[model samples]
Target: MQNMWKCMEDLDQYLTYVGGPAGALALTGVAAASAFYLASRPSPEAPLVPLDGQSILQNKDTPSGPEMIRVSKFYKEAKNGKFLSYFHEDTKTLYEGFRRGAKESNNGPCIGWREGPGKPYIWANYNETLLRAKNFGSGLVAHGLSPGTQTFVGIYAQNCPEWVITEQAVYCHSMVLVPLYDTLGPDSCSFIINQADISIVVCEDDKKANLLLDKSPKSLRKLVVVKEVRPATYQRAKNRGVDIVKFTDVELLGAQKDYPQTPPKAQDLCTVCYTSGTTGNPKGVMLTHENVMAALCSVMAQLGPHKPNKTDVLLSFLPLAHMLERCCENAVYMVGGAVGFFGGDIKNLADDMRALRPTVFPAVPRLLNRLFDRAQQEISGSCLKRTLFNMAMSAKESELKRGIVRKNSLWDKLVFRKIQEGMGGRLRLMVVGSAPLAGNVLTFARCALGCLIVEGYGQTECTAPVTLTVQGDHVPEHVGPPVPCNHIKLVDVPEMEYYATQGQGEICVKGSNVFKGYYKDPEKTRETIDSEGWHHTGDVGQWLPNGTLKIIDRRKHIFKLSQGEYIVPEKIENIYIRSQYVEQVFVYGESLKSCIVAIVVPDVDVVKCWALENKIPGTLSVLCNNPEVKQLILQDMVAWGKEAGLSSFEQIKDIYLHPDPFSVQNGLLTPTFKSKRPQIKSYFKPQLEDMYKILM
Candidate 1:
């Protein structure tokens, strides 16, 4: 044991030395030897059978209906008349859950935030956070805000200590938390404020306060700013008959008086999360305490031995307004784990990661794709480095195929240590959700990071996760079986020629984790959740031979071309985006047109590299309009489509290269980074027409 430790220490020192000038040559020899040693190791132990799940038939009359799938444990529990519901029986509400976490953690670090760019994170212990939540809840009551499940409290902010504190405070008073973000737009905010009857809103700063004041909703009577409120903003609020106060002042007001806690019941509404609709006004998804608790239970079950504990630290950077991030933070808190907020700016995410060294990371495909691109770029810089990287990745991938995961292998030390260090050097598990991650990217991440990367699939309606890939599951294309909290089945989609009997159709979920309904729209609620209680997800899925689920297409994004063929734009976009030259893509087809067109946002770095190689000189915007550049990208995309087995009509007939990427700031993407297809089409209407005209 002592010799092993000494060897690891020596390897670390050698890796550090190799980064300097003199040791470069020596490092190449070391890397080659390490790769050879790794490849020569004896065959690993037999791979563990994936504990994905079993499928059971639910209907006898419907012979063609697909059987419902459930994890083995959940299936057994259901047969025994017992279901896993909450994290803890005693912790029925969010307030009680936090109190239990505080007790179990023994006043350990609960929430933390950085003071500034170069400063260390400041932590608030569990006891301190709980007390502050209590005080804040009391303050809300003192400010004439009702304290009950009927009262909705709005929180408009980025991920910060104040945001979690405000959420806990709302739970303490049994009130519903309605989170708002800038990407939802001003009209959506106004509609939500009026629909939910939110009387008080907690703003991150004076700017957010002014945004709410400008809306001037009838239900909004007061604003609580986390930061200092400018005099002008206060006067503006006053002119609108809305009272404005600092967040700290409210806490101080509650500190002088004691208020009894009003904890919510199991079925009480915990939050009203609004969805960023593609075409209509956002719908408020009402998730109950039981719903969220069930989701936590499901997450824990999915993690198994890898579930987070008090020692784990999560870096909270994804938008808290989204259910995925919110559920991730809540899961961390439930286990008494510490959560550190990222600096408001995303560019400083690396700095934050280095400072926090988070043990667990919850991410989205957009961010992971960027990391994958960066790693590829770094590896392709030199011949020797690229050779070593490929050798290391091959060795690690071999081990992964054998159900073995190791972060301290010889290859890890000789070749991939720098990649691990770039991500804080302590990431044990990474959960990817909110969008489908390409299989190649997932495989590369697992090999490079030397950690378990689990991909989950779900939406806000299901409290973030319907199914999560389990540990030791090496297959990257499928997102494992249904989670313990929910059972899933596929229903037929005749228009798309997808059928449950054929193991391909729309995904439907049913369980405690499902949201109650759309806040006040019974019609929409009925349209989503059928009478049988299964939430019909518009995403088309296929059941793989291994019993795992794979998302194949989207029903809502399908459009019929004039030739009487249906085109799934999102499906085509996913294929085209695999091209190195394409960063973002929007595929558009009109009912009156026989062919489809695409607007592509080329990856500037890769395109510029290509331009340099071809001796073509132009800026990104100029290159976007260059016919040769457009043809190069179109050819690459066509190749990708062909490789993916896309039909001829599904391939792009004409292409337009756009200089700018789709982004939330441009109202072309949701906060979760999903492209808003309708808005993207509208934004590029002229370009689409020009492409069609040229093609004609």
Candidate 2:
């Protein structure tokens, strides 16, 4: 503290001493303010954003840890459901129906290869799945192979039993399962495999097999293919010295059932999920059984116990390749919960939701954002639609505001129940995570969907599940308390400077769920995990009085403007992308800017609709920059910006509505769907330069 004061004294020239002692006090205040400015600090109450930071602060702005813990105890006691528990002797015992039914998994809904939508009565607990995974794993180990001490096996398929089969088999046999994006190309797909020294790879279908087979890296030895992969595909692959084996061939060597082999220890490594690679090169995030167990415990501790007897059905949509889906997969297994796979491609989520409709669901903010955007667009483009929608929305919003948040509502019955029914009418808990969600989303999902909605904060490094908002803590943007036994701390982080002067700081976490370290990178591991065992999470966060953790943005993401104020682009982009016309947005203006700027990928349908209304020529995308088109988009941007109460400095000064969506094919985005800001800015410099030309 003395050192801080001495440093302040060195900047005495800027001090104003206008009224003697009062003046000196003012000067002290000025010094403190300067310190805050130098670090781009926001006080505890005012986070950089309202919904995210404000909601969190409401839950945690209490005096001390004990006080917050006390509040947590009260909430837990008040919660309607049972608390989640780790699998004990009692939980491990199989129910009579489940034990008998699991053995005939092949006859029930085949969740594996050649599967259709889902006959989920078979679920994740299918006896066939357990046998297949165990046989494949044990056989591989017995083949005189170490199986794997720390190798990466990338799973590049959609939601199928093969995905989990390969994962469970490998992990139970002491290998790390690396889930890859099904969209990655040969070069990028092989880059990480080579970098991580992966030798044996298990993938669904021959397409992925060919990727590994084509310009194959030398480090990889055996290529294991599942489902659609054929023996013929290996001919080209074998020329390159890669031993291509079938999943069936690999499974031929193990004990069937009734004679279960050794189980995986808690500390053995389990999975590795690649980082989004938005900022730089992709990294392989290695997780162990301990990490997976920790995340489950953390999540379960907070959500309370799952009532398997209640017959909960969880819909799996968001790519199973993601850590979020993987975590849910593992958790459901502990409770013997049924898992329903979403039908159709990613584009048909809404359509499929109406088809398979599970009891519980998990989604990213982008998915939830699309839902709201679609709802608004439905209401906007029509007159009668707008009137009815607005009436229902207003009533629903009012009930939410009045704390009457539950399943019984006339507005929901009339206007929103259809959406719920489309999702199979069994949604008990709708979980959202992986990004910051708007409070409005939480409120609407609760009121309209007639289910408990949850939001959480986590990273790939932590094996995904961390602090999650409990069911009853339905407040917007508030990520609920730390999972059962985990510890979350708000340290004075250097990353806090990027956010506006709302309360912000770096969030450090340590708990049963935190990772051991990065795979094969000790120096990097040491840098992230401090001596006291706390992981230095790069995120800046605020805590609400109720102990919900609200993440602002990454500490390293803070970029300065020419006017000297900081701008957190992530927060700004979330606001801009709320428009129905917008499909993707990338906000920039880090260094030389009086304010912020953005580039956008507008939806073709929305643009076409606008183009027709305005009688613009040359098609929607080509007409996007037409004087008429630009004017129309600009009006929406301006109106939306104002509605969010944003200052001009943070408003979008220019937009290039690219018709092209960022894809791995174009190298514009990471496989995880996060925009590569630097690449986008560097690629579109001309338009960016031209954008400021007229605005100034």
Candidate 3:
């Protein structure tokens, strides 16, 4: 143990001086050194399962639930479940699944992207896509990889067709894939590589490669540059015994080599997806071929209209590293649909959306909220427009609740048609996931957009889906019933006062969709998946009246105040955000504080409007610090809290309104657009402390 610690220290120090592939090799040497030391020692008793870290204990009995939901149930119960017949499910492995889908629609255009707005789209048909995947797989073999070798491949890129090809190649060759999000920090990139023991990495560009170089894991042996590599990078990698190759070269080499005939097995390890860790180090969720298959099958069984068709086109902008986007890509491929990649820039997503005119769009809440906010801005531009928009929105909401729509609806045609047309007129469905969608966005989209909005709840551990809202059953608050693949039940969370018997408790899921375990972490695996094969999700949920699940709060995020009063910060924050005066908020309370203090970022547009309404003159910066403005916002927040039924102790006592909003660029928001509370608290610790003192 002491030797191991010394070696790690040496490795860390050594890595600071090295750069590029050499740095990665130097880091990998530490693992080699540890292996050498272990080899020299006297042999210890080997575990029964050959000690690959998984527990050797026999499987236990399954837990009791309200009968596990099955595909047949989905077919019988879902609103448009008959569409399940179109799903290609005879194949067990993802590679085979892709093959069957591609074969069924060989010459159809599949993936597309453009250089910029008005640029002609570059496309690849299904036949071309499959050929490229095979060539990429052959390239892996040419690079001395073999099927069933437990090789780990890392894809460190943003959303691109190459990302999809590389992913499919890795799976086709039966290698485990570790996806590193483009937004991840250098340290996180290294941590994932080390945790997954990835030997080869395909980076998006030279800058991303350099980021990996700063903290390159010792396990990394090769760097595959997708765009281009600098000469210095090549030299650095060469010096460190790392093989650096261009993606095109790999494909060319693979085209000359024989492709592997053996495909991935159903239970084969598919991916090691590391969670976007908020509080601590991210854990790698080990998903299998079976797990992904189950998730895909379940989605098809539930979201009937979502099954893509020949004419269906999708806009892909979200980070492909996210499971939701990845699963959507797979589903699109299965149905022989087209996916139009964004123009490699988020600032241009709107232009891309308008140009592509996608029929299917999968979005996170942040994007939807932005659209809603934009509509509000336009509507509020003129009093007449505001009144008309409100009338249209209200009428549509009524129509939605009544479960009916009129052909060539007058309100929709006059007031909301422009909004739909602006978003490329042909949108049929928008699937929202990754985080809870705001209620206001749901209400507005349902009435104004005239497109189906499906909001669902899921985590990475369950292959990105466990429950989802189905077509024709748009209960925005409830994340539809558990999908066909899993059985879900509630378990008591005593400390948080969540009770299973009362239909409110921590959600526990069990089925093929549940992950095999966390990669290389048996203790964490045991903690997550119990003896009864249930994955104990830390989220709290209650059964909705319609037999669906309503996620309330996180069991792990509830913190007790100084007075021993428990506070669910998310609930309070959500309530406070309902006020148009706020943009973003972080609720913080230490153990010594009797009341919570908030860090708020006011909505500049709304606040400016308020200043105008009250005949106060100032810029946003001035208004943010104005005592009168602060008091006005505080009153609204308090009112919102009271309306939410929060206890007095739970109400935010004082606030430090921040001028800047919480964003991914500032390390305050995750890639999914969820607030990173720990980072935010740390960033504003001094301000929060002063505010708490004032409250005291």
Candidate 4:
């Protein structure tokens, strides 16, 4: 604390020396204002209390341990009208599931999208989706698409009715669906198209179609334009032996022909989902119809008897290329629920939620964090509001401590009720996955949203979720017990010295949910999925006292310094991010370095407020590069590291403050929001070299 005061005094002296009394006065005023604002706002309630080595599951009489203990009974158990065995194993393919679902509720609303925020809505019933899917399949056949060949068909589009139709058509025609995220750049787009050997690509717009055509991979022999195609662009494609077809033209041709009678078998190829490639080139994850079915069905079994049905509505805004949203889409359809699309603009997502009035919401942690941040920001805007909000939060925290948070309380009516209405008052459950959520954020959301918020854990290889919090479970630290139909175990990671006996090691999974293998990479496949059929997830986890799994870090991401100090950058990064000053951060260390270096993206609002208080001269971007500002942030990080109880070597020895946050568009973040460490390191190589040289 003395050191911080000394630094501030030195900064003030330096500013006065540089620009006279005016500069010093500005710094003093800004600092005072920042201090006042921070002091006025109430601190957020702390993260949920830990289990204190007691097993919550055992205490509650829930089935305990690694969860595989009950796998056999759950797999074969026939309770109520549910199937006795694996029902998904009986379904030949996803197309069959869709066909059956469509048949059972032909008049039910299926797919829907809105033109814009508060704009007109569009929808298609189950019968219409089935009819269009049939037409789409026949249209593909008319274009010489051979069934049973497992040809690759790429869908480079967002979540829309057309994307759904294309997916169904791929399944109906016995072709493999390869999804391309809408945000993918040309290089990644080319790499995936060529890697997957995709012959036909369906794009959402002319811009995306043209971009793909520009890459013009040799395997891409046809292009289907879903929205609009100009004559000149069509002629250009035709000249290159690339058949250009309109989405409507394909449907018309399909209407003229009969839909194929034979659907792919259960074990046949379904989709080749490519990883977001945070490390290097993305690998194509080959999933069979059975694999997808198992994953979706496992989720259903985990949900118990109350599965989503026709009365439920879900808002789909996440990229379809990602496994979670894709699975959510299929699962909603499987349960015969209506799916609504976002209004395209992210800024209006809250409005979309209210407009759709969705009953179920499946989301990622980043989205959930944003929602929490927005709520807090609004509350902090006024003194009276902040006081009321703090009281409500305190009441909620008291309820959490007493294990009565799930019940209606006075705070709910006084505060949380309006918050819930903002998120479409009908929402019963919200599933969060794709990334670990901050426990405090999770706790606040459950209290604020007035709905059950379940955290799920899994990767694309397992289709979606491997472990999910049960409907009644509210523990925030653990992700929850492993879902039925899947078994998980921990194996010792010798290099990191993590052992299963100590309740920490690399997570390994085996079940119907695991993917077949990486497409065209038998060596990698063998490496990941052992002879025993257990897929080594490369994720580090520990068993909580409750027998639920808690992810600690990524095994592959751990690095050792020259002094043999093992460090998990992600773990450290998470700690640093807890500070309000940090927006995003990347920790870098190499074998030759005895200490770590960091690249940080400051929370602009926090930094700007601090800059004003310190009388720092410049805009937020300029302040990022100012030596004093940089040093101040470094000091803040050092203080945070101490607060987190990090080891000496784990502390950042030096840092480079980046003005811009890592993002997908800049290739420093994956579509899923995980940092692309290699890319980030490469992008800041010069800055890193400079820091190392200064230390030398």
Maximum-lDDT candidate: 1
TM-score of each: 0.78, 0.66, 0.71, 0.71
Model 3 C-alpha lDDT per residue in residues 591-696, reported as the tens digit of each score? 3345688999999999999899999999888888899899999999999988866657678888888889999999999999998876897899999989967864
lDDT score of residue 170 within candidate 1: 88
lDDT of 4 by residue, 13-132 (tens): 222111101101223444453454345433333323233422222212543443322121234331111222135444546887776666556578898888777775588999899889
lDDT of 3 at 332: 74
Kindly list the per-residue Cα lDDT of model 2 for residues 167-262, writing each as its tens digit: 667655556677766334466567778877777777666877786677687777787676556667777777888877777877886554222444
RMSD of each: 11.9, 18.3, 19.8, 14.5
Better structure of 2 and 3 per lDDT = 3
The residue-level lDDT of candidate 4 at 279 comes to 37
Any runs in candidate 1 off by more than 4 Å, and if so which?
Answer: 1-75, 79-83, 558-696
Q: Where is model 4 poorest over a 10-residue stretch in terms of lDDT?
A: 15-24
- Location of the lowest summed lDDT over 10 successive residues in candidate 2: 15-24
